[model samples]
Target chain A: MMSRGEPSIRLESVNHWFGAGETRIQAIFDASLSIERGSLTILRGPSGSGKTTLLTLMGSLRKVQEGSIRLLGQELRGASQRSQEALRRRLGFIFQAHNLHESLTARQNTLMGLQVHGPGGDAARQNAAVIHILEVLGLGARIDYLPEKLSGGQKQRVAIARALVSNPEIVFADEPTAALDKDAGLHVVRMLKALGRTRGTSTVIVTHDTRIIELADRIITVEDGRLLPG
Target chain B: MTLLLHLLLRRTPIGWLQLMHNRMRLVAAVAGIAFANLLVFVQLGVVASMNSVIYLTYTPFRTDIMISAPSPQLFGGALLSRRIIYMALADPGVADATALHLGSMEWKRPGGMSKVLIVYGMAPEAGAFAGDTITDQQLAMLALPNRVLLDSEFKDVGKDGSDMAIKQLSPETPLEFEINGHAVSAVGSFKLGSGFGYDGALFMSDQTFQRLIPERTSGTLSHVLVQLKPGADPALAVRRLNERLKSEHVQVRTAAQMIADDVNYMNTEAPMGIIFGIGVFIGIFVGLVIVYQVLATDVAAHMKEYATFKAMGYPHRFLLGIVFEEALIIAFLGFMPGVLLGSGVYQVMAMATDLPLGMTPGRALTVLAGTFVACALSGSLATLRLRRAEPAELF
Candidate 1:
C-alpha cells in the first residue's frame, strides 16, 4: 500500500532512443528524478532536448527502454502492454496539439476522460461531474460548442478539463498553454497549482513558457537529452 | 455478454460521432457502399430470377413422381413408350398417371416474323396440372379445335414498332395466328411467364397437338407424371417405378428432384447461368474495392483520434470496435437503398425481357448478409492503418 507521502513519480537511470543501427539517436540518457505528491513540477527545455520524451516515459504513454520508472506504485520497465494500459488509466495527459475530437462537443470531449474508467454510478451524476469540471475550467458557456466553433484557447482549456475530470493521481501536460495568451496560460497553471494544494494531485508540465515558472514547486531543465544540475 | 454490450454501448457512439463529423465524407462513403450493394443485388437478382423460372416451369404439374428418358434435355426427354406409364401404374401406390406431350413450334406473327414458342399438350378432361394460373374454363377452351391459351406475359416487337403479342393478339381481340401452318386462335390468357429458352407458351389438347404436328406416334409420350395414393411415400414409389421401368429405358425422379435437376443444369451447365455466376463474382469484387477505399480513407482521417484513445488506456480492440461499428452502420444503411433501387431495376428488367425477375425476402437477406461481410472485410483492412497510430508517436 502506498502512503500519503510517497512520490507520485519515480525514475532511475532511464534511457531512451529513436531509430536503429547507425541512425539510432539517443533521446534521453540516464535521467533519474522523483516527484513528490501534491507538488507542481515543470520541465524546461528547448525543442529536441528530450523533455517531452522524458515526460511521456514517466506518464506511461511510452515504453521505458533501458531503465526503471515507477508511477503510482507500479514498475513500468519491461511492463506488458496491458499493464501499461492499466497504469495509463491512473494518469492524465495534455498534449501540445490539444487533440480533442472535433465532432464531439466540449462536454462530450471532457466525458472521454472518464470513459476509460467504464460505466459506474448513475449516468446523470457522471454528466453532472463532467459539466462541473468544464464550468470550473472557465468553459461553462462553451460546453455544447464543437472544437471548430471554439477558439484555440478554448480548445486547450477543454483539453485541460478532459485531463482533470477523472481526478487523476498525476497529470502530465506538454505545453498545455502554448496556444494561450499570458492571462489564460497563467490561469491554467494557477488551476494546476491550486489542484495540487487542495487534492494532493501531482502535476508535471513541459513548456518553454517562462511566465508560469514561478508557480512550479520544482523546476527541472534538460539540455541535449541530459538533466542539468540545478 | 454483458461486457460486450457495455463495450458496444460505450464505443459505438464515438464511432457514430466520428463518422458524422464530416457530413460530406459520410455521404460519399455511404454512396460508395450502396453502389457496391446495388451491383451485387442486381447480379444475384438475375440468378434468382433464372432459378425462379426453372421452378415455375414445374409448379403447375400435379405429380408426386416424374418419369423421363435418361438425361432429359431442354423441352423434355425423347418420346417414351406409353407402356412405361402403365408400368408405373402397376405399383399399387401409384394412383394415376398422365402423359404430357411437350414440344416447340415457330409462332409466325401477322407480319411474317417468327419466334420460338413452347407448347404443352395434355387432355383437358384429365385436369392433371394443379395451378390456378390456368383456370378450368381456360382448360375447357383447349378442347375446341385449333384453340390455345396464350401466356399474357409474352412480348415481341414488330417491324411497325407495335407489341406483337399484346397489340395484335389479345384475348379480347382474338387474332388468329399460324403455329406450324395450323390456324390457332388465342382463346384466352394465362400467366406462365417465359423462360430463357422460349419467349411464349401455348396450351392445347393432345388431339390438337397430334393434329398440328403429325410426326408424333399415337402412343409416344414426352413425360409420364404420376401421383401417389394418399398416405403413400413418393420416394418409395419412385424407387419401385425405377426398378420396374429399368428395362424400358426410362428414368424415374420425384417431382422436386426433377425441378432441382433442371435448376442445377441451368446453373452449372448452361452458358447463360455461368455468365450470371461470373457477374455475381465481379459484383462482389468491385464492392470490396469500393468499400475498402471508403473505409481506408475514414481510418486515415481519424488516425489522431485513435492515438488519443490508445493513450487513454483503451486497448487495440476498442479502437477496432469503433472501426467495425462504422462499417456495420454503413452496411445496413447502404443496404436499404440498394434493395430499393435493385427492386426497381428488377421491375424494369421484368417488363423489358418478359422474364420472371423478382425480389424475395430470402434473396434480400442473403444480399444483406453479403454486404455485412464485405464491409467487415473492408474494416479489417482499414485496421492495418490504425495499427500505425501509437500514443508514443503522438507525443
Candidate 2:
C-alpha cells in the first residue's frame, strides 16, 4: 500500500525501442525519474528526442520493455492487460491532437473520462460533474457542440475538461495545447497547475512550449533518448 | 444479463452516434442491404409457390392412392392401360377406382389463334372427385356432349402482348373452341392455378374426350385414382397393387407421395429450381459484401477515437460491441423496406404468371433471421482490422 504523500510515479532504468532486428531504433535509454504528488513536471525536448515515449511509458499507454516503472505503487513490468486496464482507470491522458470523438458533443466526450469508472453515481450527478468541468475549462457555452462545430481552441479545452473530470491521480499530456492560441494554452496549463495545488493531482507534460515550461515546478530534459541532469 | 444491459447502455450510444453522423452513407448502406434482401425474398417466394402450386393441382382429388404410367412425366405424356384400374380394385383394401383420361390439344380461340391446353376426361359420377372445387351440378353438366369446364385463373396474355390461346371469357358468356376439329362449349369454371407444366386447362366427360381425340384407344387411360377403405393402410395397398400389376408397367403412389414427387422434380430436377437456389446464394453473397464494406469503412474512419478509448482502458470487447450494434441496426432497418418491396414484386409476378406467389409468415421470419446473421458475420469480419488500433501507435 502506498500513502497519499508518496510519489505518484517512480521510474528506474526505463528503456524503450521501436522496430526489430536491423530496423530497430532505440527511443528511450536508461531513464530514471520520480514525479511527486501534487506537482507539475514538464519534459522538454526537440522533435524525435523521445520525450513523448517516456511519457507514454509512464502513463501505461505503452508496455515497459527493459526497465521497471512503478505507477501509484504498482509495478508495470510484466503486468497483465487486466491489471494495466485497472491502473489506467486511475490515470488520465491528453493528446496533442485533442482526439475527441467527432460525432459526440463536448459534454458527451467529457463524460467518456468517467465511463471507465462504471455507473457509480446517479445520472444527474454525473451530468453535473461534466458540466462543471467544462465550465471551468471555458467551454460551458459549447458543451452541446460537436468537435467539428467548435474552434480549435475550444476543442482543446473540451479535451482538457475530459482529462480532469475524472479527478485522476495523475495526468499524462503530450503537447496538449499545441493547437490552442497562447492565451488558451496558458489558461489550460494554469488550470492543470491549480488542480495539482488544490486537489493533490500530479501531472507530467511533454512539450517544446517554453511558456508551459516556465509554469512547471520541475523541468526534465531529454536529448537523443537519454535523460540529462536537471 | 444485468451486466450486459449496463454495458450496452454505456457503449451503444457512441455506436449510434457514429452511424448517424453521416446521413448519406447510412442511407446508402441501408439501401444496398435492402436491395439484396429483396432479391432473396423474391426468389425464395417463387420457389415456395412452385411447390405449393403442384400440390394445388392434386389437392381436390382427395384420393388415397394414384396410379399412372411408369415414370409418368407431368400431365399428358404417358398413357396407362385401363386394365390397371381393374387390377388395383381386386385388392380387398381398395374401395373404389376411377380412370382419368388426360391429353393436350391445340384449340382455336375466338380470335382464330391456336393455343395448347390440357384437357381432362372423367366419368360424370366423378364430380365427387373434387369436393370443394367442383359442385355436383357442374358434374351433371359435364354429362352433356361438347360441354367443358375451364380453369378461371389461367393467364390470357403472353409476354409478347399477343393472345396465346384463351381470353377472359366468363361462364355466362357464349364461348366456343375447336379441339382436334371437335367443337366444345364452356358451361362453367373452376379454380386451379397454372404452373411450369401448362397455362390453361379444360374438363370434359370421357365421351366428349373420345370424340375430340379419336386416336386415343378406348382400352387406355391416362391415370387411375384409387380410394382406400376405412382403416385400410395406403402403404400396404400400394405394395399389393404394385405386386398385382407387375406386368402392366404402371406405377402406384399415394396422393401425398405423388404431390411430393412433383414438387421435388420442380425443385431438384428442373432448371428453374436450380436457378432460384443460385439466386438465393448470390443475394446472400451480395448482402455480405455490402455490409462488410460499410462496417470496414466505419471502423477505418473512427480508428483514432477507438485508440483513445483503448488508452482510456476500454477492452477490445467494448469496441467490438459498437460495431455489432451498428450492424444489428442496419439489419433490422433494411429488412423492413426489403419485405415491402418484395411483396410488391410478388404481386406483379402473380399477375403476370398466374402462379400462386406470395409472402408467408414463415418465409418472412426466415429472411429476417438471415439478415441478422449476415450482418453479424459482417461485423465479425470488420473487427479484424480493429485489432490494429493501439494507443501506442496513435500517439
Candidate 3:
C-alpha cells in the first residue's frame, strides 16, 4: 500500500510528556509513524498504550514537541491554536463517549457538526447537510430524539454521521465502537470503512478490537508507547 | 453588528430553555427580586401620601405665619389669650390675624361614653375654608348657638351628656364646663373636619372653643394664624414677630417653614421615619443578595455548557452578551411581579391607612428600573467564573 510512500500524515520524532517534573507521565515517547493518503489506517494498542495520544497528536489537538508533524500538507509543529483548530476542522473526530451536546436533539447535534464546519450561519446548507448525513446513517426516524432517548448504537451512528458530514480530508475515530455490542460495533466499523472508501476520506481508527483491525487497509500495533514493525 | 446579534441569539437557545425547565427556581428568583421592588414602591407611596394630607393647611388657608404659644414641639402647652386677636390684626403688615383654639374637650355620648375631644376652633368667618361656600352640615350648625357640627361620626364633646344628640341647642346656650373655672359660652359650631384627626377637622368660632374650655381662654392665646398682603414678605414679618416675642415663650413661624419643620421632625424625631428607612435598606440589600445568588447558581450549573461554546470558537464578548440578555430577562420579569405585589400592598395601605400611601408614577418607574439594573449587575457578576474556565480545561 505504501510502495515508495506518499504520506497522508507524517510525524517525525514526536515527544510528548504530561504533568510536571517528578509527576510527569510520558504519554508519547519519541513515537513516529506515517500513513498513505486514501487508506484506512488502524492504530492497535491497549487502552493506555497512547494510541489516543498518537491520534490527537496527528490530529493536532495539542502542539508537537521535538518533532515536525505534517497533516494534509499543513505543518503542525509550530502552528497557532487558530491554525490547529482549522486543521482539526479538516479532520473528523469521533470520540468514544459520543460527546454530543445533550441539550440538543440527535438531529441538532449532527447539524452542529455541519454548522461548525460550514461558513457559519448558513442555515439552509447546514439543514441540507444534516438531512443528508442523518439519512445516510439510517437515523431519519430518530432525528428529533435526544441522545438520552437514542440507543447506544444509534448514538454512535449519530456520532459517525457527525464525523463524516463535514466531508473532512481525515476521519480519526478513537474507539468509536467501544460502547456498543458486537453486532452494533462491527456495523459501525463496516460503515466507517465503507464511508471512508466511498468518500475518499483518509480513515484512522484506534481500536483494541481484533475484528476491526482486520478490516483496516493497514494495521499498526503498539506495545507500551512504541509502534511495532509491520 | 447584525452578525453579532444573530450569532448570539442562535447560541443562546440552550441557555434560554434551561430556565424554562426549572420553573420553580425561576419563579423563586423572580419572586425574590419582585418583593424587593414592591417594598420600595410601597414605602415611597406611603411617604407621598403623608405630603398629600397637609394640603389643607398648606394650600387653601395660605397663611404666611403662625404664632403659637407653648411652641408646637411641646404641643400640649399651647394655651394663649384671645385678647391679642384684634391688636395683631391692627398691624398693616399683619393684614389679618385669627386667634385659634387648640385644646381638648370632654364630650359624652350614650353608647361611646365620655372622652376628651381635640378641637381647633377659629372664627366662623375665617380664611381656613379659603372662600369655599359652607356645605349643609357646616351651615346648619353655624346658624345655631350651640348646634355642634357632627360628621357621619358625631362625637359627644361636652362629656356631661347634657344635650345628648343636640336636640338642636339655641343661640344663647352657655358651655357648662370649667377649665380652671373661667366663665365662657359654647356659641356656634361649624362643620367637623372640613379641616380633625386622620379624617377631617370640625370648625367653630374662637368664642365657642374658648367657652368650652375656660382654662385656655385665660392663657396668652394658643396660636395666632395670620395672612399677609400679596406683596408682603412673611419671612421678614416673622422675623419681626420673633424679635417682638423674644421675651415671651412663643414661636413665630412661616407656614412653609412650619411645614418643612413638621416633615423633618416626623422623619427624624418619629419612629415612623426610622421604620420606613429600615424597610428601604432591607429591601435593597435583600434584593441585591438574592439576585446575586440566583445568577451565580445558574452560571455554576451551566459553566461546562458555556465553556463548550467558548471552545467551539465563540468569543468572550459573545458570552458576555448572553449574560446581559439573561440579566435583562430576569430583571424585567422579576420587576413586574414586584410591582404588582407592591401595588396590592399600596392599595391595602391606601384604604383606611393613617399613613399616606402614594405612588408617584415617576417613583414607581424608578423603582422598577432599579430592579432591572440590579438584576443586570447580578447577571454580569455571575459570569466572573467564566474567566477561570479555560477552553482546554473544559474539554
lDDT of 1 at B191: 64
Q: After superposition, how far is residue A16 of candidate 3 from its true place, in Å?
A: 6.2
* Per-residue accuracy of model 1 over B205-291 as CA lDDT, tens digit each: 888888888998769878988888999998888888988888888889988888888888878888888988888888778777777
Q: What is the lDDT of residue B122 in candidate 1?
A: 80
The candidate that wins on lDDT is: 2
What is candidate 3's TM-score against the reference? 0.65
TM per candidate comes to 0.90, 0.90, 0.65
Each candidate: how many clashes? 0, 0, 25
Off by over 4 Å in 2: A1-6, A119-121, B1-12, B69-77, B110-114, B155-174, B239-251
Q: List residue ranges in candidate 1 displaced over 4 A.
A: A1-4, B1-12, B72-76, B129-145, B152-175, B186-189, B247-249
- Candidate 3 stretches with Cα past 4 Å from truth are A1-95, A99-103, A107-125, A156-174, A180-230, B1-12, B30-45, B48-60, B63-200, B203-270, B289-294, B320-327, B333-337, B352-364, B387-395
- Candidate 1 residue B183 C-alpha distance from true site, Å: 1.1
- In the range A1-230, model 1's lDDT, one tens digit per residue, is 36667789889999999999999999999999999999999999889999989988898888888988989878888889998888788888898888898888998888888887865546677789999989887899999999999998899999899899888889999999898999989988998888899998899999999999999999999999999888
Model 1: chain B TM-score relative to the native chain B: 0.86
lDDT of residue A7 for candidate 2: 88
lDDT of 2 by residue, B34-146 (tens): 99999999889989988887676674456788898765244634888787878888899999898788787776654666666777788888755553776677788888898
